[model samples]
Target: MSHSQPDTISAALARGRLGISSVVSFVIAAAAPLTVVAGGATTGYAVTGVTGIPLAYLVVAVVLALFAVGYVAMSRRIINAGAFYTYVSRGLGRPAGAGAAMVALLAYNAMQIGLYGGAGAVLAQFLDGYGVDAPWWVWALVAWAVVAVLGVLRIDLNGRVLAVVLIAECVVALVFDAVMVSHPADGGVSFDTLAPSHVFAAGIGAALVTAITGFVGFEGTVVFSEETRDPRRTIAWATYIALAVTGLLYGFSAWAMSVATGPDRIVEAARADGTDLIFTLVSPHLTDSVITVARVLFITSLFAALLSFHHTVARYLFALGRERVLPPAFGRTSRRTGAPKIGSLVQSGLAAAVLIAYALAEADPIVHLFFWVTVTGGLGVLILMTLTSVAVVGFFARIVHAEGLWRSTIAPNVAAVALGGILAITLGEFDTLLGVAPDSPLRWAFPASYGVAGLLGIVWALILRATRPHVYDAIGLGADRDTTALRTPDLVRHPA
Candidate 1:
């Protein structure tokens, strides 16, 4: 407990700070339920012209729940902030782990920065109603500053902020759903959109991918395992709870919107009103003040997601740094708050740079920055989940464990095939998801960047193996600096 040993304190996250509810809040806020329903779902309807969005949400939820069965099972044995990176390394090999690490950093950074575009645009429009005009980047910078400050504070403090915003966002969204359902269009309460047949239709790939993006943040439950109290139970419960809540909310709300607009006209309304479709639906039924409040919550919903993703990206960097995959400086933390100080600042700096670059080019915030970038980030997460599912089987194959066949072998194998198929479908529909021409290079370019990152990481891991063997040996062993020897043993492990 001596304050003199700064290295010991700085290398570790603040332990025993987060509980089940706080962890759930962090995961769900990252999903940004309100933003996904208002922005993502509407975009799905407009861009893909798919009415089966509700079914897509439920489908992805089940797929991820299967993914989580093995995911949380692994979390009990290995506690690391690197999450996917560590799991892949321990289960696969060091080189693959390194590749997964870089992919994760790139993906999470894309996701965190992409939110600035949506948050900035929404905030700017909100202020425009008050006759205070400013560019979207200006509002984005303001949000950037706030998230940057909070990123360096205690992990639980960030969780508390997210919990409050997330609760209000969900409440408002539910109210809107109730109002919309009660005032159905002429067809009156049709459940056609929720049908399974619609899931296999022509544009179903795009709709499924869009729904997958909405659940992108649920896997982040393991990203916080290092800081949670009783991570074994806490992480498992939080993962399931977050998935169930977001999935149910998204599916119910999407169905309600269809009920309000009528199944046939839902796509038309989405195209006309865009993200404003939800508010427009409720406007005739509710007062102006309530609508205004919902709009403000929309902005806050984006902000909450921004903070959550920032934390996720920062922790990934911290894990890499702690393992010496990156410079040791990236691993350092603030002793007082136990936050990943250097990693947090680095992510914030990267986000600011991207914002400035986009602003300089006068890019469309909603289209180019938010929609394209976030969809690509979702693609990265999809890739990681597929890889991690495979890794789960590998990891269990090498060990003696008490976990049942369902948790260790059967579920992971099924999830791997399911997610792998989804990944293929998503890649095929990337153009549709981006609302671009099939011949457009942007579709290939965005997905290819992840390949480049993975390749570079693999090369770097090889370099480390030759030039710096110790660091390479510790590639996925975050905070457990002395466990390198145990890694080679056929060990019987127990839950933490």
Candidate 2:
């Protein structure tokens, strides 16, 4: 009875209650299939034309798979909530990890807060359709409130909510794909869409960049590793599964959409119809009621994405806090649900501030708030992933593990180079991606913010090293522990 008491107390404080399925749901929710289809696919068509969009997804998938080979290997050794920050630290050093952590905090928060602009815009439109008109920011605040509530609850509860939304999203997409496939437009189902030469005919670089952005949230599998049932196996399996599912689903849907609209006309249709192109094609077959259902599902999909990202940002804060890199208050979890209560509240505060500022400035939600911020966030993630791949190679090169040559060295290097090239192209064509002028400061400003954040992170680490050596020792290596030693006031904060 005495031994069991400690176990119960530990369980209540450190909540690692998530499993493989729950982890998968969190990642998929972050990807937000409906948003990808509605936004990414439409943009891909407008930028690269039809034949190349599917191919772009396939290529990015292969590169990320190579990246994951080393990523999963490191996850087994260093289990922490910091994700890229932890992996980079394991491979590089604590300062570099701290830099990555700053990047991650900025990237994840940018991504999450950016989604509010989209959710508000979409929800406002959905409400408008039902004769309930309101300002976009008002709708955004509604979602903010709901997500804030969910973020403070148990993670398993969030998982269940995401699972239901994810299922509805998948169902609607599959049904749409089936309808499109069964009634392929004039040219009929053509394998021509899958041809490499055809896929790159319009523009290879643009298509590849857009496609990679669609897979943004897959790397987040490791963020939940501490909460998962089995960190090593769960992280590895979830990473692979999330990547495969996202790539296949995205590739298949783009192809079906092209076929539904006729390959030759897809670009024109996308340019003309935007996100409504696919809905228009499928609307002819499905009942009128299905349209309303899909629109509702679309709103829920954005909400799920918001909640998933909120949890991700909160966890990052929680991990950093536990290391004394940030305030230790963020490290506190609820005894009842094991949720990072303080971290969740912190994230919510940030989101509210951003939303309020944007509203005050009267910024255009879609253009200024959503696309501008999300595109920046996506670029930051790419940079982090590229660095992580390099870190992986560096880590495995020294450490003698049984994982073999391919997993340790070769794959990581190749992924890093490929990703580096993509990053260069993305920068070169920044104006085109942002739909802005060649000299737009917004183009340079967003990417520059990341560099500033990284420099700040490095400085902060050096300060910690000089002032508090003990706290500096545990930067990216922070994880929950029961030991009384090292449990300083600056370190782990236990639940009361």
Candidate 3:
């Protein structure tokens, strides 16, 4: 853990790309297709029954909106590339901070690599219906290659591409939802769908889980906190606006889907259509050309989402390296592109390793690799959010004018409590969540990951303290630390 500062960490502050705007920022944040394919309303209906799903969206949106209060409040104060980890480090201490950062890297990397399986399956089905035969992994590898290119490219270019895919697909989704509202289908547009009665229905916890996933890539906007026009204003506004906009899109679309099909029947329909039921439901509702366009948008959205996740992983690595936890090289951004080149390569290598392992095992990419990995990402994110909430409390503990204790401190704190309970339920229901048996491999893989990451982090901290106190001092604490190794009071924390 103790190595002299490598040349990489000493590099000048990155004038990161201004590639992202509030518009594109929001799109990439909200419109990731994998989560939506579970269908916009799918979570609502399944969790609270068709009736309660909309309410779940309202509930999560409002609750997390509370969390965003602290998130944005802190962002205005402290702007940095590292998201939750940075905030935790500032408030909680460097060791906890380093632990969170490395684990987040593990979690997000799992998500990006998981996308390959999902992309492969979707592409395979698209081709198979036309008799252009190939296994899902072929398409998955093709996707992996394309996203790898996007990940290493300059940030502006990547933003533009993501904006296009997200906008087009999201617009198509909205148009169909509009149609569904007017069409009088079972789950379509009824006031009853939004009722509180439905919110408390059968699978409320499950619905909350699904709704939360769509919000996954949203936090990533802060990954480019250093590169944005005004880190303070840009980062805070993006988080709030993105969450508000994404919440509306997801909630409204769910309501519309219910209206398109009767609420009672939408579940049965989804059983047949699966997550893509909304896409297929509206296929016959739209012209052939429009259907093709939506289909194409679907694939590209998946790719854009993958690249978004990939960049997040790189940033996490960059944060760790910059902080001197991992090799300092991971902290380095390419002088040429202003992207985290070293970290990007390391992330891609790890992903390639996982993909190869899955391929070698003849595993079902979507079922095994994608599903398991994404779930791990889900768990990790939940944990980060919870810990980060505690960090928020610690942060406001020292602030003079309590501008948003309720939003940042109380609300998010409450959300974190709810999230903890949900995560516990998720752990217990892993078998049900993954549609596997009690003794399924997934049972071991899921919870085992949490334990493994925790142990490694604890060990790393001990090693740093014993062998590399200097580096350990920098672990969760920021460079804002004086030589005394405590973060300066004026230093701001990032929200998760």
User: For all candidates, what are the clash counts?
Assistant: 0, 0, 22
Stretches off by above 4 angstroms in model 1 are: 1-9, 483-496
lDDT of each: 0.90, 0.81, 0.67
TM-score versus the correct structure, for each prediction: 0.96, 0.91, 0.88
lDDT of candidate 1 over 1-496, digit per residue (tens): 3456465357789999999999999999999999999988997888888889999999999999999999999998888899999999888888998999889999999888998999999899889989999999999999999999999999998899899999999999999999999999974789989998986787777888889889989999999998988999999999999999999999999999999999999999999998899999999999999999999999999999999999999999999988888987788889899999999999999999999999999999988898888878888998999999999998888887899999999999999999999888888888888889999998799999999999999999999999999888777777676756355443223111
How does residue 34 of candidate 1 score in lDDT? 99
Tens digit of per-residue lDDT, candidate 3, span 78-138: 6667888788876676667767776787778766888777778778887887899998878
Best by lDDT: 1
Candidate 3 accuracy as TM-score: 0.88
- Give the per-residue lDDT digits (tens) of candidate 2, residues 1-496: 1364323122222446788889989998998888777766776677444456877788888899999998998888767888998777767777888899999999989889998998998888878878998999999999999999988787898899899999899888888888888898884697556677954353566577777777888999998988888899999999999999888888888888888888777888888876667788889898989988998888888899899999999888888877889987776677667877888898999999999999999998866777668767888899899999998887776555788888888989999999998888778767667767879987688788989999898888889989998777777656634444335431222110
Candidate ordering by TM-score (highest first): 1, 2, 3
Compute the lDDT of residue 373 as modeled in candidate 3: 65
Number of colliding residue pairs in model 1: 0
Off by over 4 Å in 2: 1-13, 47-51, 191-193, 198-203, 480-496
- Estimate the overall C-alpha local distance difference test score of candidate 3: 0.67
